[model samples]
Target: MKYDQIDRKLFIKNRKNFMAQMKPSSLAVFNSNDIYPVSADSTMPFQQHRDIYYLSGVDQEESILVLFPDCPKENHREILFLKETNDHIAVWEGEKLTKEAAFETSGVKTVYWLKDMEKVMFELMTQCDTVYINTNEHYRANVETETREDRYTKWLKQKYPAHAVAKSNPILQRLRSVKDPIEIDLMQKACNITEKGFRRLLDFVKPGVWEYEIEAELMHEFLRNRSKGFAYTPIIAAGNNANVLHYVVNNQQCKDGDLILLDVGAEYANYSSDMTRTIPVGGRFSKRQKEVYNAVNHVKKEASKLLVPGTDWAEYHKEVGAMMTSELLSLKLLDKADVQNEDKDWPAYKKYFMHGTSHNIGLDTHDYGILTEPMQENMVFTVEPGIYIPEEKFGVRLEDDLVIQKSGEPFNLMGNIPIEVDEIEDIMNS
Candidate 1:
């Protein structure tokens, strides 16, 4: 791992919180993600399953975390099984985690090799009456590929047909949504790295630069600062390309007078930071562009303030939609007649702003949080509101990551990044 060693207390606290919620005599198992194949003799880079990594700080593949809080044997209470490290693996793929190192990283004293998993699991299943299986249950999840966790779940179920089965996702979703102070610090580090990348573009961006060139500059900055790279696939959409949400083919040349919508952020220690900033290509926003930019910025600012504790997610979006509708009406994009005739499901503002105003952001880009539940303190969300004017051949979006506070306004993690028209223009021109 390029990042520094995180304090083990974070994982210890996470495990305690999770175990506190488990039903008595229930055991939960979490598996690390597989190294997916690209082709023969090649594979995609490994990404640790966030749930396991959250509970245990083990960031390696072929690892499993088990929580048997009520087990008869105290050693089996919290166990970590790893793909045992040796000198051969040390030379071939660098050293994997040793038993002593795993204990330090995860705070779990009991460790075993993968070879002993079946025997150890057999003993565990006999003691626990219920098994908790981790599944991809995030609201935005659309997984099709079979995972290591899936295979293990299948084997466990087939072997123990009499045991009661339960889901771990619901428990994790609620727990992972609220940020730990250490996790918040890590996310703040990611946002700081992203700020460095965005600031680099202020001077580097000018007319005639390819969109990919801007992406490259951000990558360079992120890499040098110890970030693994983008938290998610970056959208370096330039000009009309910005009208296409999720545009990633950054091939177009940024022409003079056009705006570049940079939806990019760096990842630190597997935590994510999502930000979107629309900047002028030639160091100045045109009059019309500035109007749209300011409108989007206004919505972003107001929308973020509603991310306080006790705010309902659905109601928050509705309020932001109303604010955006008024802005669109003033911009002449929507007439009063358009508002009256609009579909209830899709309002007049939908013509300009088609996506949701905000979502939970953290370990995953779209982090875990129940939309039906009211907001809670320490929950992080991204406030991204945009106006995509395809007919006008441009788009404007302003976004920032914020933490829901207890009483007042949310704390903006990306607050240091330039956002106001004057600040951006001055920096670009300077």
Candidate 2:
């Protein structure tokens, strides 16, 4: 891992909270993600499963965390199984975590080699009546490939048919949605790195620059700031490309007067910070472009204020929709007739602002949070509102990551980034 070690107290508290919610005599298991292969002798980068990382702070592959809080022995209550490392393995694949290192990384004291997993698990199964299984149950989840957890679940269910099975995702979704103070600090670090990237782009962007070049600049800044890189696939959409919500083909040239909608963020120590800012390619926004940009910014600012405690995510979105309606009307994009004839399900503002105003942001860009539940303090969300005009060949999106507060307005994590049109123009031209 390139990042510094996280405080073990965070994981200790997380485990305590999780075990408190588990059924008595129940054991929960979490597995590291597989190192996916691209082709022969080629593999995608290893990314630890968020749940496992959240529970154990074990960032390495081929690892397992077993929590048997009611075990017969105190040492067996929390166990970590890691891949055994030798000199040969270290030479070939850098250094893997040793037993002592695993203990330091995770607060778990009992560490076993991967080869002993079956023997250890058999002993654990005999002591527990119920088993908690981790599964992908995120609201936007559409998994096609069977994960390591999936295979383990199948094997465990067939082997221990009599044991009662429970899902861990629901508990995790609720727990992970609310950020701890340590986690909030990590996310703020990521946001700080993203600010560096955005400032770098402000100086690097100019007419005739390729979109990929801008992407490169951001990556350079993130790497220098100890971030792994973008939290998700970055969107360096320039000109009409910004109208396409998920545009990622950053191969186009940024022409003069065109706006580049940059939807990007940095990930630090597995925490995510999402941000979006639209800036002019030629260092100055045209009169029409500035008008649309300010309208989107206004919506973003107003929408952020509504993210306080007790706000329902669904109803909050409806309120944001109403706010967007007035802005669109002010922009002359929606008329009184269009507003009157619009469907409630698909409001008139959908033509200009289609996506949801905010989504929970933390470990994942679109992190875990129950939408129907009321918002709570320490929950982070991205307030993004945009106006896409294909007819004008440009689009404007302004987003900021915010933490819901106990009092007053939510706190903006990306507040330091240049957002005002005059500030952006001044910096770029300077």
Candidate 3:
């Protein structure tokens, strides 16, 4: 873990909140993600499951957290099962958490080694009526590979046939959707690191630089700032490449007259910060490019205002679409008939701006939140609106992470980053 330690109170509160929503006598189990093997003895880096990390501040592999709020024994109510660590593991890999250290890190009093998991779990199952299983139910999740949690869940249900099963995702979806002040501060740090990476490119970018070069620069900044790396796959698309929403090849040369779209963010302490800013390769936007750029920026500003508490995620996109349509009509990209005859299902504005304007952001890039529910204060979201004009050989997108508030407009987390036409130009040309 390259990031700093997070406050344990956040995890403590998260567990308490999730347990509060559980049925009486119900217990929940969470497992750390597996260290997936690539080939041979080599393996991909370990990434702790966000849910487990949210519930407990433990960030190690081969760890499990069990929450049995109504257990007969008081110590059994909150327990942690971790892999036994000794001086041998310390010599080979690294020093893992010990019993006393685990208590300090997660505030869990009772800790057991993995070797005693079955015995302890059997004792717990006998005391609890229902078992809660953690599963991935995020809106954008497409997990094909079976995870450790999946395997553990399968075994748990099979071994304890009489125990009732309940899904932990629904409770987590509602709880993780809102952010605590500590989580917000951590995300702000991630965004600030991303800001450094973005600012580094303003003067570094010029004609003839490869897209991969820009990606490298951003990585260097993020790593130096204690970030493990990008929160997601980075998109350093240049020229027509920017038109492709998920373009990440980053192999093209940045031409003089083309715009480069950078959809990148840095992660700090497992919290994510998402930001997208398109800039000119030659340190300045052309007259027409600035026109479209301002339109996208204007739409971004207006959309942020719409992220107030009680707003619906589905209706917010529709409102953003209407706003984009007006901007496109003013840009002469669409006429009156294009909108009048537009399909209600697919509006005329879809031709240019296709993706949703905002999504919840925190633990994951596309963080967990029930889109059907109304927005709430302290919920973080990304306001990204773009116009991809492949015919014009360019595209423009401006995005910022914002937090919904009880009153007034949402607060912009990336407010310190340069976005205005003159500011970007001055920074690049200075």
Candidate 4:
């Protein structure tokens, strides 16, 4: 891993919390993500399953975490199964985690090789009446690929048909939604890395630079600071391209007076930080450009303030829409009559300021928090508000990662990064 080792205590605490919610005599299983293949002798990079990493801090392939808190054998209460490593395998591939190293990394004293998994699982299955299987249940998840976890789940269910099955995703969704102090710290580090990337672009961005060049500059800054590139596929939209929310074909040369909407972030230790900033290509916002920029900035700030504890996710968005509506009216993007005659489901402001104002941001760019539940302290979200004016050939968006506090307003993770018009102008010119 390019990132530094995370303290195992965080994983230990996460397991304890997850176990506390499990039914008695229930066991939970988490499998590492598969090292997917691209072509013969080629494979995509191995990314650890967030659940396994969250529970065991084990960042490797072909690993499993078994939590049977009320097991007959004390050592079996928490066990880690890892792929065994030998000198020959070590020479071919990099050295895999040894039993001793696994123990040190996961704080689980009992470790068994992957070859012994079936035998060990048989013993564990007999002691537990219920089995909790981890599944992808995030709101934004649209997975079609059969994951390693899916294969394991199928095998486990077929083998133990008599056992009561339960879903682990619900518990994880609630637990992972609220950030632990350690997690918040890691996310802050990611945001700090993203800030470095954004600042680097301030001076590098010129009228004629290609959008992909800016992407390369950000990648360089993030890698040097221990980040593993973008948290998600970056959106380097220039000019009217920004109107397309998911524009990523960053091949165009930024023209003078056009605005570049950089919806990018850095990932540190698998934690994500999401940010979006639209800057003038020539380092100076035109009068009309500044007006739209300030309007979006105002909506972003106000929307962030509404991310405090007790806020409802759905209602919070409605409030943000109202805030954006007022701003659009001021900018003449939406007329008073347009709002009154607008559809209740799709408000008039959506024409200029589409997309949700905020979403849970953490390990995933669109992290897992139950939208039906009220907001909680320590929950991190991205406050992004934008005004896409295709007619004017420009778009303005400002986003920041924020942590909802116990009291008062949420904390902005990108507070140090320049956002004010004057600050951005000065940095780009300096």
List clashing residue pairs in candidate 1. none
Model 4 misplacement above 4 A: none
Model 1 vs. true fold: TM: 0.99
Cα deviation at 392, candidate 4, in Å, is: 1.4
TM per candidate comes to 0.99, 0.99, 0.99, 0.99
Candidate 1, residues 1-430, lDDT tens digits: the string is 9899999999999999999999999999999999999998999988999999999999999999999999999999999999989999999999899999999998999999999999999999999999999999998899999999999999999999999999999999999999999999999999999999999999999999999999999999999999999999999988899999999999999999999999999999999999999999999999999999999999988888888888988888889999999999989999999999999899989999999989899899999999999999999999999999999999999899999888899899999999999999999999
lDDT of 2 by residue, 4-77 (tens): 89999899999999999999999999999999999998999999999999998999899999998899999999
Model 2: lDDT of residue 92: 98
Better of 1 and 3 by lDDT: 1
After superposing candidate 2, which stretches have Cα over 4 Å from the reference? none
Candidate 4 lDDT over 281-367, as tens digits, reads 999999999999999899888888898889998888899999999999999888999999999989999898878888888887888
lDDT of 3 by residue, 225-251 (tens): 999999999999998998999998889
TM-score for candidate 3, please give it: 0.99
Backbone clash count for every predicted candidate, in the order shown = 0, 0, 0, 0
- In order, candidate lDDTs are 0.95, 0.93, 0.93, 0.93
